[model samples]
Target: MANLILYKQTDLSDRMTVNRSHQANGGMSLFRTTSWKRSFVSSWLLRLSMFLLLSLPNSEGKAIWTAHLNITFQVGNRIISELGETGVFGNHSPLEKVAGMVVLPEGWNQNACNPMTNFSRPETTESWLALIERGGCTFTHKIKVAAERGANGVIIYNYPGTGNKVFPMSHQGTGNVVAVMIGNLKGMELFHLIQKGVHVTIIIEVGRRHIPWLNHHIMSLFTFMAATVACFFLYCARRPRMPSTATRRRRQIKADIKKAIGELELRVLKEGDKEIDPNGDSCVVCFDIYKPKDTVRILTCKHLFHKACIDPWLLAHRTCPMCKCDILKA
Candidate 1:
């Protein structure tokens, strides 16, 4: 019996140990699953937020319309004006109207590859402009050099690779001057005109061009807002009616206004009336003196005006014109 009792006690101890181990393992597994779920949810939320932020319209750095370049010259007996491709305006550049005679560097008149590092001023000595090709330095550098030499504006033609496609430019820190770029083809055309001794005048004018993506987003937002407003109105129309306090107050106010208007006193202006001096009192609407035998209406606030004038004014304004007293409140 003593051996059997010892055996039974050992068996009970082993069973309790196994049970405790299984419970601990189950708790650890549950904790690991919870941790993974939390991590996954947090990562998903972060990614969603980033996507939303990037998807919104960029209010800063809005795209602007490009300026137009108008080039004019005399072809034999007739005058010719051709529009050239325009590029971006420089930052802090003046948008005011700039008109001047086009000039090229002394040795660079016929050469498209002219670096224009040393440009010659025009012989006329009036407000003249510089024509340079895009190469050898930054846009700001070329513009700044030309501006220092007293050029009213600087026109840079695109490189050969850009063909006839004009693009906007950023020349920050450059002096206040009008700077524009043209396509390679337009530049060559103007260059040849100058080479042929044809005097050309170019005009830079500010113009508007719509950005495709911005217009699309604006239309989409407008449509969405209109639909939302329409849906809200529809919901209100379909919603069950309840007499709220505001609605009841508005109705009471309307009724009071009608009652006040019905009880308003009417009088006729005469020469000897003590209430009104026809010569002194003028109709505010017509700015005319009140005449004898004229009919008028008196408001609750004791302000008087011609019936034809005050009736229409009260119907529209719902208050005394001079005193601004509310008939509904009275």
Candidate 2:
């Protein structure tokens, strides 16, 4: 019975791993995702960002900085100007009647490796939105092609490999896509609305998006900087020549050693007395936190809990949970 149960759990875990890899590697989203971790993390990050921004007191009238894109259509025999909120952005801001053009690419239709190549075959750019395929290329190439082919801008479609994403080159340049980046989710929806002759005026306000779970970009930079400086100062006070290259090299070597030890420890998850459950529920070896809802399993003994809880504990005892006997405790 236990064997059957374990086998089922293993199969389920494999499926979960595949699903997670897809989402993590940009195969799905929370609303469209099939797993728990990816959806949970994305939702959590968004919520946390909003919470932090809201928590701050509003001061200097510029409370809560955000990015907004006002889109207006520029269509005419020659060039129709005055899009939705183009001129309204700010007068004397270097934009004339037709400040910029928008590229309406087909969403979920293209890959970065291969893009719509026929966009420049003297094609009539009369579609409400352009249908671009992604493949064998970078965004820059697609945009460049669109520009040379008389396209005001471009929109790249979403694919199974690339995550739902966008990129606006405001501080960069006003080339293809008219200096704006947008995701397929919104663009595709907007295209349908426009095709139906429905006026699609929108104010895309990019709010402060904070990620709390893993250090993505800014968080990673700050964390590493802080950790490095903290270590340097802590060692400085202890060693007279701590600020020297020799001290730094020694510390670096220690870090490498620690990493090797950690790998070995993980590879040998079930060691002797060195392993024990200091945390009642969490994994002792990996220091990974555990939840009560986790699966409980016994290693020979009937005593059971989260597999993670036992695996880490087994790093040392590696024996019957109840008897405290060592079988693989070496």
Please name the candidate that would achieve the greatest lDDT relative to the true structure.
1
What's the C-alpha lDDT at position 107 in model 2? 41
True-structure lDDT of candidate 2: 0.40
TM-score of 2: 0.28
Clashes of 1: 1
| Model 2 agreement with the true structure over 274-323: per-residue lDDT tens digits | 23344544443345544434444444333444555555555544454556
Worst 10 residues of 1 by lDDT: 1-10
| Tens digit per residue, CA lDDT, model 1, 1-330 | 122223334543555465456545553444454655444444433433333343344323445446678888998999998773355454456665687898876663322243344555456768777888887667787787777777899888877755666655677886678887667787888888887988888888876643534653564466556655765665576444656678889788667666777789989988777645545767787677777798888888988888888877776678998889987777
Candidate maximizing TM-score: 1
